[model samples]
Target chain A: MNHQKREDLVKSVLFVFSITASLILLLIIIFLFNEAIRLFQEVSFLDFLFGTKWNPEQGLYGAFPFVFFSIMATLGALIIAIPLGVSCAVFLAEIAPGWARDATRPVIELLAGIPSIIYGLFGLVIIVRFIKVSLELATGETILAGSIILAAMILPIIISISQDSIESVPKSFKLGSLAMGATNWQTLRKIILPTALPGIFAGIILGVGRAMGETMAVVLVLGNSENMPEVVKQLLGKEGSSTVMQLINQVPEILFKPGEALTSAILLEMGPAQVGGLHYSALFALGVILFCITFVLSVASNYILSRSQISVR
Target chain B: MINSKTSDKVMKGVFWFSALLIISILFLILGYVFVEGIRVVNLSFISDMPKNNWREGGIYPAIVGTFYLVAVALLFAVPLGVLTAIYLVEFRKEDNLTSIIRISVDSLNAVPSIVFGLFGLSLFFYYLKDFTGGPTIFSGGLTLGFMILPTVIRTAEVALRTVPLSEKLGSYALGATKLQTISRIVIPSSIPGIITGVILGFGRAAGETAPIIFMVALNPTMPEFPYLFSQCNALTTQIYYLTSEAISIERAFGMAFVLISIILISNYSARLINKYLARNIRR
Candidate 1:
């Protein structure tokens, strides 16, 4: 009876400790919302979400620019990363020999472990300079620089997860395709990739979440400008050219212009904003927006990942 | 048939090119930093204090501060994480409460590091200012603790799950209690994995700059011996400051090198531990 009581006590204690993660998460949501809700009282929700300007000093609190930049940078990064990451994943999963896979996996893990700040530094010293000198831009801290850095930062996640998913397509699938006299590439493209699509999609969504939330590297290389990218204005203005030609000329300009992201705005302004003031609340509100976006993405990815795991099992 | 063969050849080339591209990028970053920063990494640079407005001298204080913050973070995280992993692996049933805990862990892991910084500033700096000394190492460390908690829990849980059920059965056959089997048999077998988790968590905490920038790290100062209740510098924040302010490029590279070295070493050692454990388990 005494031993049984002790066992029950230990189990209960462990149970309490296990709930610490839940409790901490609860506190985070409560505190973030509590602080963020105060801003909606001052700024209308629609205005905060859709307003174009973000001057906190004049109390404009327009967050659209940062949101736009976040999306733009994430899209740009995806454009660069998806092909590279997926192809690398395919290579490692389907083509690499045992020793090559073993060697390459650790290198990728090391790349993932490198601090984001170092990536920021590398972007500043190498990428930004290269851009400035080669393109003769006023400043090298363009959305392109940020995207490049982010692409590298997010590559490991995409590659590793996609690789796992691709590899998990049962050997029988490949064998069956081969038995049908399909080419290796055809086997992969038709059988393996389609089966792994959900998992790969989950990885991509997680990568999007990562790109959206990345702060330090973006802060360094994004130039943190509040103005809309010049290309957007040019395209919108439709200045003195055929629409198709104007778009072709202006599309590349988008990558070269300085921009601010939601994460960068928070990191840059949190210091200057007065405590418990509107600016401070607005920053927290930005956090709230970021939190909501990443939370939804993560939950969606998790759901997809779990479903895929179940299907595989 | 010719078309199919050509397409396969082209796709194969593309795949190899992509893989090579990634490997080259990694080498380029590492090699550039190593070459630019190797000159400034002698013993004195590691031991002395900054002399001229952070343009000259060493990064001793920042190094110490990084270790201190990671130590404090691990102090909070390891116990909570290991215990939580223990509960999940050994005691959890397929129930709502367990599901809730699992979801919370995943959600917490998904929360951005910057958001955690904001949350820390609000909770520790504004609300619990008196207790946390309003953005001290204690507050920053705790914030990081929360940020890396999920990582620790997940890795430790993986390790704990790998311990064979037959080992526990044998313990029970000897009339051992569940607690005894856990403490003596399960934990002993999983120590290497648990240590790997702690080391990986340490690497993460040490590398993180966003969560601590506002909460704890301030302008570089000689970190006092017992500076838990005071603001201090960190290697990561130092790199951020150096590059952002254009204070000293060489020093920034040097700090980046040191920081990368620490992170890479921890990561490699964790892999080594995992490999060793796998071998032992197979045996």
Candidate 2:
């Protein structure tokens, strides 16, 4: 074949290969929905989503507790992560010296690469035990433990992305702020951070998505309770104010420990749920929920970033 | 927040604390795992097979299993990912479709590994079991391959895109075909970057625990001992089983130690390779 014809053929083949990404995504969504939708045949969607109990053995498929805990754990992690992650980003981008930045950057990369299993181990041995003792809780496996571990796990992502945003803020903004006799910190707070807010928001949204999707690390630490939130009872006692208080005061030790968080519930159930059974389909439904959440958040993050980029124009 | 008399000091303290917290967390995990697992990491610990549900003996099968799965995954991911990247940065270069493909790939990268696990189960195990014969090396490796495909494509694309347009133009000026120019000029120059991507992907695949769990379902025996059609074990899954079911935290730590070091070493080398290539380019 002539060179031009050969090139065209190769280009076509590569183009076909390139589209494989979108194809795989479509396959994933289809597969998740295909299996997940079957659960509604066995259990009502409303009961599966909003009911307070979830025992596949008894055929009760209320996943409300798991869903609630997943969001709660993610929000808890975000609370710890946002301030710390964003501050670290600011320090790295705006304040840290070259040597300091160089030293910490690898640590952050290494931090990101550590497996969730290892993080689970860490949470199991350290954080869980620590919380159990220091917080004087019935079990250290509270949602707080999961949140702490996840916060640490998601830190590198939040810091890296936010740092990119902070760094991308034009240097002229700093100069402009300093020219008005503003201090360096003042310039950062008033000028650089504001300029980078949208990007920073995008990073946090991504981090939240990450916190939601995290499985193993969270599974190990989250008390894996699949019970309704006892918000009022946990609050009134105020001994630990955390889910620990709920376990301690609200729910009787008589009640079985809260069943399992969403991911853990699916994971724990997966082993026993007979293949092609209603239980299996129910587990797949949870997987579908997990997929939808992270997928939506990822798409939302991209949308925010694209909108921010265009809005600047 | 930065306006008070003590605000400067407070900000400095917080900044230092943040930096210290990040560094300390890294050290804490590294130090604790090494301290706990160092005693168990003798040669036999790595090379010997597990006995009695991993309560006793080494994790040789798991060590080998990790290599097998990662190797198989790379076997599938590297070629397709690199070719797809080539299409993006070289063949198609720039267009609306290219951008859309790029965005899709990025989102795919962010999908939780657990989601991939679910897809792998439904697609590979339940649906394609006839071809895969159920949860063997083919199924597990293919699953992990697709899991890391985005990473490979992304890194390789970035590398290919970095190849100067001048070089491709020069090749064209000499009457070289696009394929020839790419093979001779573009791929060769971007090989370092592609290797870096593979290395990074290696780290990710090494540490990933969720995606391959159900696909392979942890096995006690070594994989690829004779063939890729058998079920296999991995360090991550082994650690999970050992710690949870086997109730052997020490052994789990030992396995985790190996796993963490492998991931960290690959991650460091990937970063180091990038720096070296950059310095060489400058020179």
Best by lDDT: 1
lDDT of 1 at B119: 92
- Please state the error at residue A216 of candidate 2 in Å: 0.8
Q: Each candidate's DockQ score against the native complex?
A: 0.81, 0.70
lDDT of 1 by residue, A64-176 (tens): 88998898899999999999999999999998888878878877887888888899899988999999999999999999999999999999999999999998889998999
- lDDT score for residue B80 of model 1: 95
TM-scores, all candidates, are: 0.96, 0.93
TM-score of 2: 0.93
TM-score of model number 1: 0.96
lDDT of each: 0.89, 0.82
lDDT of 2 by residue, B1-283 (tens): 4355478668877987898888998999999999998978888898888887787788888888888899989998999899999888876747789878977887888788888888888998889988887887778888889889999998998898888989899999999877889999899889889999999889888888888888655557765544678788889988888776747899899999899878877877877887887677544
Worst 10-residue lDDT window for candidate 2 chain A reads A250-259
